[model samples]
Target: MRKLTLLFSILLVSLVSAQTLQDSITFNPQQQLNAAQRILSGNYGKAVTVGAYGEVTYNQPEALNGELDIQRLVLLFGYKFNEKTQFVTEVEFEHVQEVFIEQAFVNYNVAPNVNLRGGLMLVPFGIINEFHEPTTFNGVERPSVDNVIVPTTWREIGFGVSGKLNNLSLGYQAYVFNGFQSTSFDGEGGVNGVLKGSNGLRSGRQKAIQSTIDSPTLSMKLDYYGISGLRLGLSGYFGDTQAEDDVEEIDGANIGISMIGLDARYAYQRFTARGQYVHGSLSGTEDYNNLTGKDLGSELQGWYLEAAYNLLPQEKTQRLFAFARYEQYDTHAGTDGALARNDAYNRNDLTTGLSYHLAPGVVLKGDYQFRDNAVSGGEVANRLNFGIGVWF
Candidate 1:
């Protein structure tokens, strides 16, 4: 880890020095837009913009009946108040019934390379949490690590600064956000804590729905694209969970958390590769678990590597990609006092599939997964998945 840090520092310095020497070139804000920015960037005038994206999926477990559903449909609405300020929002419909305000934020361009943003926004944790448009990723479903460990689509009300350094090919984000909820109480005086061993901090996502903030969290992410055909990211999050007012003074009602993530993506000719690693440590878990009667782990870790090759020629409007990925994650990587680790929490998956892009904004996908766990004599179920994704 130290070596990796040193190498990143050296590369960053070299890029900065090179950029300093080329200060004469003009900077185009459009050229510097990242994936999220591109999605939010509307027409070049002061007007309202509308867009939508959605996915339909089918999944079949071995020896089980297949299920099909409209996984998600998101509508994007943005208004450019002026060149200097804009408001963007996304409304999501999950499973054709559940509704959510995925993001609703205002951005003010304070300078050519910096912007001040505020409102309910996505947490910049890893790749998928922010750039999760249906057409943006390969596979019928997202990586398991992203789903369980990093908790994709996690969001909270926050304020932050974000921008790009075009010359250095770097983009940066820093935010102060509301943290997760560790526990809550019911009207009937029942303990309803959200944190558990099965999904780590996933269930704690407050989603800004009349959420409480006894503690604030800090999140930051840096993206480097100085090297041709490659993109690298480093992310960090730190803070403590919140508890309902009723349990505000109770011991173990909240836990301190610190997490870090590293990810990279590379594309060269017909080949592409990507990987991510995430680790988190929890403080006061022992006491928290004892109080809530929950099985929360002290440590959580996960990682995955994927590679893909395009089978079609570059000139073709349509393309086909064959890909494979291997993933391993453990929500119970470490247990607290008197808590026994659950081997079922230690799991891995092997997935292979094909993605056919019929157009830039439309794709058909199919994949099979071999899922297993560390438990002896465990009955693991494999799955086959298919999906269609569209964006416009």
Candidate 2:
């Protein structure tokens, strides 16, 4: 912890010094022109930043294969060459030792209303779908409904555009990247049960894995804040995903997804009201020609809705804030099309939480969640969680 604090202090000093130099350079009109000339002459501006967070939870099903773990961390660094171009990336260490590159992307701002960004980037969707900060949203944790259906932080090697016009902001992304893999034919369980295989371009596993596949995906989101203390947004995504197997030609085994999301928030002084709704669909045909006339597995679909209210009394001078959120989800909203076959899988979740703002860039939070897997023939369980979050 002392080392971390020392590193943070050094970073703070660097940022302050850079800001001071920039201000001084821009103070004079001629210096400003010279600065522009220097940039046009290939001079580059850069920055180094850091961020971290942690979470711990306790659950009632600790003895039933569900142990509450105190594990979760994410760090990021970013740099910019000019006002029109930049790069940002993050590395997430979950479960303590498992490290993965969460995101890495280069952005070019072509115009105030248009940008051409490539590399891996968050699939722009509803509010917290991309940047999953605890305080940025209302819940103690992300909505379970959004997690499985829309898949938060869902990103792939893709390009997209984002900008604002008047009170409306729009963003879009599309890519061709590795898709999800199914470990079991039954289709609904653990994270390993939904594991995704790496692309062949990275390793030789491509030749031995027949179930490896790549999917085409796209997402779009729009945000509008036309009224004071009120902001609203919507997002949607579509994709055709599949898995390949050499033993069986699982042709036309493509998946199609459709999502509709809505969010509204009102903030005045210390009081805030927010709510969100995301509806999604997952469908595909199970065809294995090499399996000798074998076509099994069922189509999937799900949706969920959530709401929260933040109570912050005015006239307070402490560095603290409190909030609570209520969430609910349904794995099968409507059993139409080919989704009726998977009607046996359904779940619901409810959560409530509180948060404290210890400083301008730090937050402490705690919450309780109740989940019911109605189809798993299991009883409902309660979970308690607490964590500290930070960003810079």
- What TM-score does prediction 2 earn? 0.70
- Model 1 reaches what TM-score against the true structure? 0.90
lDDT of 1 by residue, 94-201 (tens): 997788998899999999989999998989887788867766667899999999999998989999999889998889999999999999886677667789999999
> lDDT by residue for model 2 over 1-392, one digit each (tens)?
69557856865775554431222111111122221112222223445433444555444443355456655666555556678876766666677667666667777879866667776666666655554654355445666655655566565556667656753433333343444443223434211123211110011112112335565556677767566666677776666554444311344334455667777656665565666777665454333212212222232234444434334444433334455555555544544333233323356666667767655445677777776665556766577766666543
lDDT of candidate 2 at residue 94, scale 0 to 100: 78
How big is the RMSD of model 2? 9.1
Model 2 residue 5 CA deviation in Å: 16
CA deviation > 4 Å runs, candidate 1: 1-36
